[model samples]
Target: MDDSKGKFGFFADARRLRSFLRQSWRSADASMRRGAVVMWCVGLMFTIFGVVGDVLETWWSSMPFLTNLLTSLTAFFFAVPVALLVLHDVSHRMTDRAGRRAAMAVLAQSMYRLEASVSALGPVEHSRHSPTGGPPLTTGSILEAARARFGRLQDLEGGNAEDIREATETLRTAIAQWKLDRLPDQFIEEVGRVDIEIARLRDAVRPRFLQSDLEWPLDRQLHSLAEMANDLIKRPEQWTIESYNEWCDVAERFSQDFDQKSEITLLEINAVFDLLRHVQAMHIRRTTFVQALHDFNLSARTALWELSSL
Candidate 1:
């Protein structure tokens, strides 16, 4: 029985290894295809150079025989249909890559927006319309509604509320110290609005907590996102493919970090704050980003299509 188990484990390991290799090969093939397209485009430029050089030599010199030989060689072997093939391959690959990247960027943007919106719902009390028959909602009523909507208050019962409040306050202090008062009016207004909301929520929840120590993990994440946004805003012209890729990387890291640290029960709390509205906003942003990319892809496709038709 021991020997049989050992054999089974060995076969399982072997199968896993084989599967890994197959995947690696497929990835390698795709990379090679992309590289090949680039190289083919470069080769076509060289072919054009060779043809032009031959033609110029023929016109400038009196050597008919040599000129004819060179022209014939370049035209037959280097110039004609090969350049068209290269152009087709390069354009096709570029379109495919652009479409893929655009999709990914949109996905990243949506997640980032969702995270921001969720962070906005930090144990806050606000006047809201009451579902049951009563007077117009008060801040206290809103808090109760939020608490009730987010079931299993056990997580929020402990130090979680304090942690959130502290982290938010720390973020606000940092932003204030950064002396961003001179920033664009719109940016200052947005930041001020968020800050006011944070302060209101903190004041509402402070009585229940013993201490308000900053949550290091959450603070770090907020700081990182703020820094990235600042950098991008400061130098929008520096936004390149690489910059966009970095944005995606940061957004993904933020998502993963938030997931690892956040309690699963928090999703319930999130539900209380009209989470669907936030998600809907994120979906709209995502759709807009995707549409922009789709338009770019269509433009690329049209160019290729015209070339192919010709």
Candidate 2:
């Protein structure tokens, strides 16, 4: 009877130990989940706070009167929507991990439907006759196009020198006129100087309208332009009037030598011309868009300033 009692007691203790370990594990898991939630919330809060602070600071510095109003309006209009988005994303991620596939799918479908509806309601066709019709040009777009074309030119074997000169000249001219407020004034002035140099380089490379021009001078100018371009590429930020002038001189000399040696073909020249024209068109479009944005911002800023003063 004692043996039987001892066996029963041992069994009971084993059962109790098992229960205790299971409960402890569950409690630890719950604590970890709670900690993760808290950390996520803290991170989200900080992100929203930083975004709001930045917006307010920019507004205050650029348009003080609009700062409070804009901040409040944005908090209600933009911040609320953004916060909801973040919440939705966090909830979705959590639910997904917890094996809530159906809920995740439903949320995703709802978002897609909402996006489709909004897109359908917006204007589908742009007016061809409108001066501002078609997608507005942006700095990003222009730079992308330039980089692509430059890469293509670099790939060509024994490319027509005149065409290269024309293309480079076009780019130089466009950059000279580019006015990004974010860009320093010194950069702009330097770009303009480079533009002049490119033109000079082009003139030097072209076969003399009259044969009286010395070949050595042309060669020297072409060499100078090539060297200058290489230097500029190395330190694009150091773009100055002096550097540009030197490049133009080198480019002209190189072009003149190229013109003298190569069987002057119209095809290469035409291709180069076409590229230049495209560059010019892009420049005009970008300038117009930037100008429009600048004007709108200026007017808005002025109005806000006046109202604040009153």
Whose lDDT is greatest here?
Answer: 2
Give the alpha carbon lDDT tens digit for every residue of 135-210 in model 2. 6544445444444544555556435656455445434433432333123336433433443444543453233211
Which parts of model 1 have CA positions greater than 4 angstroms off?
Answer: 1-74, 122-310
Worst window of 10 by summed lDDT in candidate 1:
207-216
Q: Per-prediction TM-score, please?
A: 0.20, 0.21
* Whole-structure CA lDDT of model 2: 0.43
lDDT for each of the candidates? Answer: 0.40, 0.43
**Candidate 2 vs. true structure, TM-score:** 0.21
lDDT of 2 at 62: 69
